[model samples]
Target: MSVLAHLGVEITSSTDDSMDNRKRPAASPNSGSFVFWSSSFRRQPARVLIVEALPPWWSDTCTVLCDALDNFLSLACNLDGPSRIPLLSLYAVSRQQECVLPFVQVRGNLARLHSCVEELRSIPGEGCIKGAARGGELLRQAVLDSLQQFKQYIRHISTGNQTNNNLSVEITVVTSQPGPGIVRQLEMGLKDADLVSLKRLLVVQINSVGDWGQDTPSPETTYTEAEESLMLGTEVELLRMENSVFALETMLKAWLQEQGGDREHLHLLLPSPTDSPNPVCVKCDMQERLISPALIPLTPNLGVKTESVRDFLPVTKASANQNQPPQRLKVIKLLRADGLCESVLYGLPLVIRPTTCWQLDWEEMETNNNLFHALCHTLRGRDLFLLLQVEPAGGSGVYSHYVLQSSTSLSLLLKPVVSRELLLPCSMPVSPQDPVPDAMQTVQCCLTQLDEEFVFNPLSLTNNLYQHLKSRGLISQPRYPYRLQPAAVLRDQSQPPEGAKTTGSRQPRQVKPHSFLQQCEGHEVT
Candidate 1:
């Protein structure tokens, strides 16, 4: 969360090629504790600039923008994590561009943002001043100019040596210009702009309710042509909202959350050679994949919602220490799988993905990525698991976890394990009676037929309640939200899966799989 690379010492004392290593609390193995990596890298905070592209002097549009900004600031302040906050700026384009506010971190500068909204509201709407820039040309100029300003700011930061000038730049353009013609012209202008790509740009188009129809909600639209026009790395997301201020504010808030409202970050040390003193570490974003459900207190009125009871409940000293020491993933040991193993999971499950730092050189970033991929590959290929000492973020206790490959990417599952000594003796006999040969053969045949007949997709699973609420219009859903995915090895243990289909001939599946083993069947114990 802390982009302290610029503040920390260099990784090595003698070499210039060695990168800067941000200092963290190192775990001492000599004390019978975990041995954690002392060095780490983190992605720079996102620099986002919101562009107002409504027609000049349009009071109604300006008022909506101001209200939306106010609500957005309020919502952002209530978020729990400070590290996920992005630096936000705003620019209004009329006959000429207006810098309503420079880039400022949203968490502590809420008052400044509120004042900026007031300033936006005070702008006199003269209703389409003569000879003012309008349409796609105006938008084109605004985007190009914004990019130039971002580059200038980064250069200035580098000159000042305050921090690494590697911040992720994102520009969100909110325009009330209705119709597809504006989008088409914008695409053409972008194609001619010398820039390579606009991957970080987001264009939100607001339209009137009457334009789409009064009975049905407007459908979201994407401008694939706009993305293609600029050779962007990712598809351009085009969000359409009705003219209602409430709807605009609600949609904008949801978009900001999707950017990264719920993620917590940690540095994971990759497995290094025993002789090497320092191991390669990469930045990772941790997210709650599965959380325990809690009973919500009922409210007397539908408009009045109940807040979390945790506020009224007592807060322990541990919970109050929001700025706890940063967490590190340390490999305690590696063991070969003998047979089926069982472990208990008692806390919320987390999914971790190794993220690339933009500040590092291309080769260095690739090396870190490759290291993570290789680690996961070895664990899955050799039928092995890693014993890790993990400290969960925003919680107490040091829990041991069995780290296994969770997906094709450098994403791993940390399943909490309890000590064997805590379990009592089994009530039944240690060994079961041998199965009949005839029955074993029949079961094997059935399993084989089922495997061949259907190809399993782990992504099919979804939270029923969440989806139900979304479908019932009770919740707003992002166009592309995160979903859980099982590793390729889980689909077929014999060989790696290809294009969601297994290629190897069917073999008798293990009757009792290890708790960490994700079976081909849809069933999962934890």
Candidate 2:
């Protein structure tokens, strides 16, 4: 027998013997074995240490530094797993050069760390009392000292008899002006460390001030160093802090992409707009309230929810007639799976008169319109189809459907009836002697198939269709209605005409327009 079956037989025999033995009173010696096995499978929580370089001369240094620390703490509070009690440490780079290194200042406990961050917030306002001649260089050394302290802490935790060695470690440096000296010192410190396994070394640069001169490193230099760090298998990123919510969200998304943990279970907490005693809880409440409406059922059948689709109607002026109300058309909005609205319609006024049945002013539509370009950006790399419904001003239920496809550019797809019969016939070869009425007859046939209530003018539709065909290069421009270009003709030149003279060698025959239609019948219009 195979090893698996033999093992299964042994397990069955053991279970049978245990069941028999349970009838007789015995000591429960192995009952706790299952608990021990499960304990071994549980994962140890990760510990993250954040070291920030806060200079006294920087503008709004305290506010920026406090905000970043608060943001990191908020993220820690939202982490998943019962054992995931995240340890966060924050240190402010000092300007004074001291002989003794600063201790592992912040502890792992959340309450204690919160108090430490609150204490550091006041340093920016008071300013550094004893400033060193080379402050940047001193700050760099302080950061290295902090890293060494963190490594010692990791070693101490792992060496304990009762401690779990599965814990991961990460170090993040937050700074506004990171000079080359700081970068070199950090690289050397990380390279020399062999005892601790560093998960990630992140450098976050907050650009609160607009000045890019002497104090701040240039973009090219920062990019080159970041690239080198990545090649060495270190996770490094430089983030510019922006006030806009959209910009901040984009930055966080890029950071999340590099994370090695489970993204679905991970939660990122940002600072609340308003100052609150408990900012993390306030932020969570605001998010739930904002997204609650989208979760509600808006349809009667509970088939389609508000989160999946939305609808809008154009604002119209009051009607003059007291007997009836002005007509309003429904515009349906559909969202992609990623919760992004791909298209939105702007309700423009429609003009109706005896001369012009029911038409929208193209000039007015183009004046203050940017929705098309915005849609292109939102729906990039995806195909978008818009179904426009144009209804008459009266109480009539009839409406026309116009399909528009939008991509890098927009195009109008002629209705199936118009394309197959009218537009296709116009491009087909015609005899030079025949009048253009033959093609016009095909358009008339298509018109008969359309609804009688369709308000668009036949002449206008024909002209627009012809222009669209010309732009797509389906047919040459009409010099004359019946004139045919040589390129448009197709004929089989294998045999000569019955009355034509035959020479010793065969010669190419001139193509006639009448015979071209037979060859082009199989061509399909895009």
Measured with C-alpha atoms, the lDDT of residue 31 in candidate 1 is 22
TM-score of 2: 0.35
* Count of clashes, each model: 1, 0
Worst 10 residues of 2 by lDDT: 1-10
- Writing each residue's lDDT as its tens digit, candidate 1 over 1-526 gives 1101111111211111111222222323332122121222133334454555443425557767677668767655433221234456677776667777775556546788888878777767665543222444666677777667766765676565466523556667776555354455455556556454233556677763223223221222234654545643433457676667676665554333223323445676554434445654556753221111111111211111112223212223555536333345568878665442442332223455656656689888888888888887787777676776654332433243444423445666554443331121222346578878975654454444332426456577676987787787644654422222347655555465566665457574444454434454456567
Model 2 stretches astray by more than 4 angstroms: 1-53, 78-85, 96-110, 125-139, 159-167, 178-181, 188-196, 210-237, 243-526
TM-score of 1: 0.40
CA deviation > 4 Å runs, candidate 1: 1-57, 77-80, 129-133, 160-166, 194-198, 209-236, 254-526
**Clash-forming residue pairs, model 1:** 57-125
lDDT of each residue in 21-44, candidate 2, tens digit only: 234333233421111111111232
Q: Tell me each candidate's TM-score.
A: 0.40, 0.35
Model 2 root mean square deviation, Cα atoms: 30.6
Residue 298 lDDT (model 1): 15
